[model samples]
Target: MIDVRDLTKVFATPHGDWLKAVDRVSFTVAPGEVFGLLGPNGAGKTTTLRMLLGLIRPTSGSATVAGFAAERDPAEVKRRVGLVSANTGVYPWLTARETLAYFADLYAVPPALARQRIAEFADAFGLGDFLDRRCGVLSTGQKQRLNLARALIHAPTALLLDEPTLGLDILGRRIVEEFLELVQARQLAVVLCTHHLEEAERLCHRFGLLNRGRIVRQGALEQLRAETGLHSLHAMFLDLVGARRQLPVTSLKSAAPPAPLT
Candidate 1:
C-alpha cells in the first residue's frame, strides 16, 4: 500500500552547498505488513516520510501511497494514509471525544460511522474513563494514545508512524504495540520510522537500515542476519556504524553508502 522509489531530497546548506537529506531511498510496505525505516538521528527517515506524505516535495523520484502518486494525487494519497508522529497532538481545550470527532469530520466520515469508530478507538486505547475529559488535562500517555486514535480516525489503508512510542512508559509502549498489531490485523500497511531497534525487531516484518541519508542495508530480519551473521537488529545496526566509525574523517565524508542487499 506504500511504495517509494529513488526518493531523494536535497537541501541547501548554510554554506550554499547542497545536502542530500534522503538519497535514492526505496521501499515497499504491503497490506498487513510493517516495514521499519530504522536509523539514528540525522539519518533522513523523517524526510523520507515527509516526501511520502507530500508534505514536502522530493528533489527527485516517486512515492505512491495506495497506488496514488503522491506528487500528482496528494489529496487522494493523504486520504488513504494515516500519520502518527511523536509531535502529533490534540487541541488542548478540546475534550477527548471532541478531538476524535473533529478529526473524523476532517476526513468527511459519516456521523454515524464516526461515532462507532470513536467508541472502538476509545476502548482500544483505554480512553474510556477520560473520553469526555479535556485533552490538556490528560496524562502524557493518554495524549499519545489519543494522537494515535486521531491519526486513524478515518481508517486509512496505510499508517506512517515516526517515533510513535517515544518518551512513553512501558504501559504506553505496550498499548502502541497492541494498536499496531490491531491495525495489521485489519490489513493496513505500516511504515515505522524509529530508533527503537528492539521494538522494531518485534514489530516489523522487514527493515531498511538508513544512514547518512542512504539505505545501507535492507531486507527481512532473518535475511539480514544470514548476510551479516548478526543475531539481532541492534547488533547489525551497531556493526554497520562500527564499520564506518573507525574511518578517518576525510574518508568517512567521501565514502559512499553501502550497497543494497541482493
Candidate 2:
C-alpha cells in the first residue's frame, strides 16, 4: 500500500548550512500490515512522515502511497490516507460529534454514511456519552479518542500515526492499541512513528529502526530479534542504535572559578 525509495529531505539553515533530516531512506508497507518507524528524537522519523504525507517536499528520492506519488500526486495520496497524531489538530470549541461531522464534510462522505460512521466510532471509542461536550472540556484521554474518531470518520484506506499515545496514561494507551488492532483486522495499511518500543511490538508486523536520518535496520519483529540476537524490542533497539542520552557541554569560562579571589 506504500512504497518509498531513497527518500531524502534537506533543510537550508539560516547559517548557510544544510541539515539533512532524512537521508536515503527506503521501505514498503504492505496492506494488512502495521509498519513501525522507530527512532529517537532528531532521528528523522517525523521528517520522513511529513514527506510521505506531502506536508513537506523532499530534497530527493520518491514515494508512493496507495498508487499515488507522494510528491506529485499529494491530493490523491491524501484521499486514501487517515492521520492521527499526539498533537491532533482539533478545534476546542467543537463538540465531539461536531468534530467528526466536520471531517466527514471535508472528506465529502455521504450524509447517511457519515452519520452511521459517527455513531459507530463514537460508541466503539467510548465517546457516546461525551459526544455533546466541547473538546476543550474533555480530558487528555478523551481528546485522544476524539482524534482517532475524527481520523476514521471517512474510512480512509491507510493510516499514519505519529506518537498517537505520546501523552496518554495506561488506559488511554490501551484504547489506542485496541483501535489499531481493529484497523489491522480490517486489512488496513498503517505506518506508525513512535518512541514506544512496546507499543510498536504490540501493533506492528514489521519494524524499521531509523537513526541519523537513515534506516539502519528493517525487518519483521522476529527476524530482527533473531538476527540481532536480542530477546526484546528494547534490547534490539539499543543494540542497533545504542541508548539515547543527553550530554551536557560546560563552557571553559564557567569551569574557571574564583580567578579574582586572590
Candidate 3:
C-alpha cells in the first residue's frame, strides 16, 4: 500500500527564486490496485515519484509505503517497492541472468531463493532464450524485459512505473501491459505515471489528473467525465489545462499553496 498526505516539494532555482515542483499532492494506492498519475511534461509527476521512493526529501507533508514512512524509514520503504523507468540502465558487461542475480544480492535475498526467483522471472518474462546474452548486445525490447525482471527479483509488494512504455513498439508495449496485469493478479499496489491516456484508461483502476503541480481532478474515468462534463480524458485534460486557449502557462508562486484534494 502507498499513502501520501499533503506531500509538497519546493526547489531553489538558479535565479534565486523558489519553484514548487510538487504542491500539496495527496493520494493513496491500495493493494491489488493501479493508480495512474496522468500529466503532461513539467507537471510534477517525476518529482512526486522521487519523493515516494525516498530519492529526495519532501519539503513538507508525509508519505508512507506499507506502513513505513518514506522519510523516516527509507530502506524499509524501498524494500517493499519496485521502480521502473524509461531510463533504467543495464550493466553492459553482465548477462541478463547476471543482472537479476546482482540486484537480488543487493536486496539481500537468500541465495537459494534468489535462484528460484531468477528462474521464475526468466520463464514469466520469456527471457529463457537470451537470458545468458550480454546486455550490451541485446535488442531494446530484450533489455526492457530484463529491466522488469530485475526489478521483481525481490518480490516487492508495490511497484512504481514511470513511462514504462515510452519508446516501445506494439509488441514491447504489450509485454509491459501483460506485466502490469501480472502485478494486479498478485495483489500488489502500483502507481503508474504516464502520458498515454488510452493506456491509463485501459489499466488504471483510478486516476489523478495533475496540472501545474496540482491535482486539478481525479477519479475513475466515468467519475471524471461526469465532474467535468467532458466525454474523453483528452478533452477533460485540455479543458483543465486551458490548452484550447493556446495552453495557458501557469506561473510558479512560493506563497501558500492550494489545499489538497480529499
What TM-score would every model get versus the actual structure? 0.91, 0.91, 0.92
Model 1, 65-147: lDDT tens digits are 88899989889999999998988877999999999999899999999999999999988889999999999899889999998
Arranged by lDDT, best first:
1, 3, 2
Q: On residues 105-177, what C-alpha lDDT tens digit does candidate 3 reach at each position?
A: 9999998999999899888888999999999998888888888898788999999999998888889988999
lDDT (10s digit) by residue, model 2, range 109-212:
99899999998997789998899999889999999999988888888888999999988999999999989988888778999998888888888989998888
Q: What's each prediction's clash count?
A: 0, 0, 0
**Candidate 3, which segments miss by more than 4 Å at Cα?**
245-262
Alpha carbon lDDT at 262, candidate 1: 100
Give the true-structure RMSD of model 3: 10.8
Q: TM-score: which is higher, 1 or 3? A: 3
> lDDT (CA) for every model shown?
0.91, 0.89, 0.91
In Å, residue 250's CA in model 3 sits off its true spot by 28
